[model samples]
Target: MKKLLLDLCSKLEGRGIHEIIDRLKLYYRYLITVLFYKPFIGEMGKKTVIYSPIRFTGLKFIYLGAKVTIFDGARIEVVDRYGNQRFSPCLKIGEGTSINQNCHITCAEEIVIGMNVLITANVTITDIIHPYDDINVPISRQPLITKKVYIGDETCIYQNAVILPGAKIGKHCIIGANSVVNIQVPDYSVVVGNPARIVRQYNQMLQSWEKIYQ
Candidate 1:
């Protein structure tokens, strides 16, 4: 009970103050934009979500998970002339993880990503594949591709990683930066390079079949 009280007091004192400070910063940003760029807004009452000082255009659709943050220059494009992107709603992110700046995650099918999944800069997650049977038709006119991609809990994906359609990555897997995965990766494995190969398999002292290197 004493620990709980201490925790509550900490939240009330420190966390509350930090939130107030963040809001102050946001308010200052709004004030500067209003004063300098008043001609652009034309008397819009007030801005709720703040935009970047630089013109980094990409946050448009479906951001879930209240703790989610898209960094400076990070791109999350979910719509186009083809149709209202049916992709943003297809992506799900778990708790305590971050997708860094310049990452592009495009989905046409469901993508269930697990908790503590660290996705670094320039990581691309796509579930669509286009048909190349006919060159006469535009790429946009190609067939809608679908294959669900599931990344298990505690997985770490590095910069420039490309997770293609239908790839099921298991828990605690470490995918090296700039790796291109086109197949399923087993749990607790380390994969690297294009069409990634497993360089290491996790050891289990219990001698379980599920833990052995495949």
Candidate 2:
């Protein structure tokens, strides 16, 4: 019996039983978070998993679609009132979209992210901009200027990219790593650099991506 027990233990160790236990714990945590937040969220679709250690504000204004997964350390906020300003904000994250760790998304008016979008780690998507028109008042205390931000279907935003107010990213577009996008990006284009500009665009007639030289 002792030899049989030792053999079973050896097999379990080789199978990485510890790793399986850790994964089970993580899934349990995710289940608890979903059950707690589902009642408060404006709309929580089926199979939407929100990982633990997330920072959320105005949960009632945020809507998440089916199979949307938000990883750990994400800060998602919908500001209905800030610094003497009142807003009716709506933040909608579409089906199958996955937001990676440490992404910050804040909206004061409207921000819509379309289906199957992949936002990598450390991305910031915001629709409110702090106005510093008055030099006498600090920027933190100033009123926010908000515009609608839209990201179309199947777009991929890479790590550390910032999507600012009034930016519209079209379908199947790619926003490169560490890029800052504050303008409109047409469909099937790849944008890179600060104040992101389209570096490559798909030409339907040629059935290929053509490089655009600045």
Q: Against the true structure, what is every candidate's RMSD?
A: 8.9, 6.1
How well is each residue in 1-214 modelled by candidate 2, as lDDT tens digits? 4764465456557456687576556556557657798989999898788885478999999999998988899999899999789999999999999999999999999999999999999999999999999999999999899989999999999999999999999999999999999999999999999979999999999999999997
lDDT of model 2 at position 91 = 97
Local accuracy of candidate 1 as per-residue lDDT tens digits, 73-172: 5554433223533443356666655677777776556677787788888898877777677899887777666788899989999999999988999999
Q: Any residue pairs clashing in model 1, and if so which?
A: none
10 residues in a row with least lDDT, candidate 1: 41-50
Cα lDDT, model 1, residue 114? 81
The TM-score between candidate 1 and the true structure equals: 0.66
Q: List the residue pairs that clash in candidate 2.
A: none
Off by over 4 Å in 2: 1-19
TM-score of each: 0.66, 0.88
Residue 51 in model 1: shift from native, Å?
A: 7.9
Model 1 scores a C-alpha lDDT of: 0.66
Residue 158, model 2, lDDT: 99
